[model samples]
Target: MQKNALKNIIYSIVLLLLVFLVYLYRKDQPITSDNPDSDVFKMVVSGQTMGTSYRIVYLDPSGRDFKQQIDSLLEVFNQSLSTYIPDSEISRFNKGDSLVYESKFFFPILAKSKEVYTNTDGAFDPTVGPLVNVWGFGPGGASLEDSVSIPDLLRQVGLEKVEFDSVQVRKNTPGIYLDFSAIAKGYGVDVVGRFLESKEIEHFLVEIGGELMAKGSNENGELWRVGISKPDEEGAANELFGIIALNAKGLATSGNYRNFYIVDGKKYSHTISPFTGYPVVHGLLGATVVADDCMTADAYATAMMVMGTEKSIALQKEVEGLEIFLIFSDENGMIKSYVSEGLKPYLSYAEQNKPSLDQ
Candidate 1:
């Protein structure tokens, strides 16, 4: 009787352990992992815990170990990049205190910001935080209808007021704020790609927010296909004027079609021009840039928007490596598009009313 009782107890314990293992397996069973022979594994990490959905599709079969490493990589990125969390490095810097000295990731981004500032003649300034806040785009908040004095907004729009030595970052002006809206998403994508590469992920695509970075080819030996969003409301994938085969490169787009509010029937772009301290009502509707780095693509898109179509296309021609597509709205409300010669092979113009060179 004693022996039978002991056997029963052991069997119950084993049963519970089995159930727990099954639950975990069910929870984490890879979405498209069965493609061991197949090239791509598409996994969607919910954006609820993190700020946004981090969609990663890796080509190689490093398997469970690769997934574990990806989880750790995400943890580090969230700690360093999340602007909402006060403890994040960016938030800590924003909190105002003893200089939260530069980390390996933060300083490089800040340093590179100066290049975009110089290129756009302060049009893409990261220091436009004061304006963004006045508009209520920051965590402290802003209002689209609030009576915003143009001069008041202009006072806080330059990079000259930001003081960053190797050890500290200080605001030279009181109302001055630093919001990295133009480039942070691209930087985040870069961080994820670098982390995956370190873990022997030779092939993958990491997208944060709307920015994307692709590395290597899938198991089928094809570069990743990424669809550029259309500014037109009626367009579908077939109407997609731009598609790129990405291999270890990043792509980004900036547009006025989304994330904007109309006040007094005047349409405003969320992509503000720092020099004017106002949302651009430029004829250009959207600009997409493809480059070796997400940060560069992100920054360049903002620069191009401020430059407008004419100047942007001219600049693209001069820059030997930049590949860009510019879409514009004419005085008549018709859509017009242009692409750099280098991007010609990958691009397809969806609209019949293409912008003319005479304009």
Candidate 2:
């Protein structure tokens, strides 16, 4: 009887050891869905890039975490495009290095900027950097006295003065500077989305700052939903004006409500118009655009803020596959919105506070 009890104790020890080993193995494995119908696993990777945060959610059958690779890719992108980086390709070009032939990133954005500049009639100009600086919005602090130089700065604020092709970029005017802040974040979103696609990730959403690109359905097999924030002051409570479902598309929002300064009871917006060389004063408080790509969406959103409500509506009608949702003040000072027909099908709002559609 004693011998029999000893053998049973030994067997119990071996079984417990096997159970512990299995537990450790499963603990190291990637998280998978509990649902038996779905074989793919969901993974999220987030990090900082381009002076902002980025989040990527992807459904991978292989359950691979791509944080390291994504961070490395963003570093390479910054080396090519980030103006804040002292020795970046764009910074070097802005400092009068006329030939940036090695950068594959700069040319495409320059080409896109030129296209948008032409289409917006120069409303979306990357060459407005000097004006931004003098207005206290850029690296240079507020020099209200330097406002006298607005006309001279305007001379340097046209994309037509800059020339570039697939190989190299050259500036016709030495003072002409390019600041892609308006569109770079959206391009970063596109870059990550393309990277995921290259890795055979069919279902993913990539967001940089507030701009985003969505492809396929989310892990729950539903279209990705994005929220638009209400046009409120900087310190106000976070609130959503509406939400929209997106698939295989990009969305971007631009608003002057948060980034502005008040001096002597007069408000100054961060959005300096390329035409007037001053902050735009308009009823349009926010502009959200949906387009085939995030870069186009971002640039057009900024342009719409400068164009105001009517011109933005007109432009949206002219451009195919372009949709806009604009928040503005009506003639009676009441808050209102204008939603394009294509965008309306995807957007939803609270019934109690539904914005009167200007349509």
Best by TM-score: 2
For candidate 2, write residues 1-359 as lDDT tens digits: 23323333333222111101001111223444548765776777877887666777878888899999999999999998887788888888888848646656788788888988999999999999998867766544566673367888899989989888888888898788889988888888888889999999998888787788899987566788876766666422236667778869998888777666666667778789999999999899889899989999999998998999999999999988789988898888877888999988898874644755555
* Candidate lDDT (C-alpha), each: 0.63, 0.78
Mind sharing the TM-score for model 2? 0.88
Worst 10 residues of 2 by lDDT: 16-25
Count: clashes, candidate 1 = 2
What stretches of model 2 exceed 4 Å from their correct place?
A: 1-37, 234-237, 355-358
TM-score of each: 0.79, 0.88
TM-score between model 1 and native: 0.79
Best candidate (score: lDDT): 2
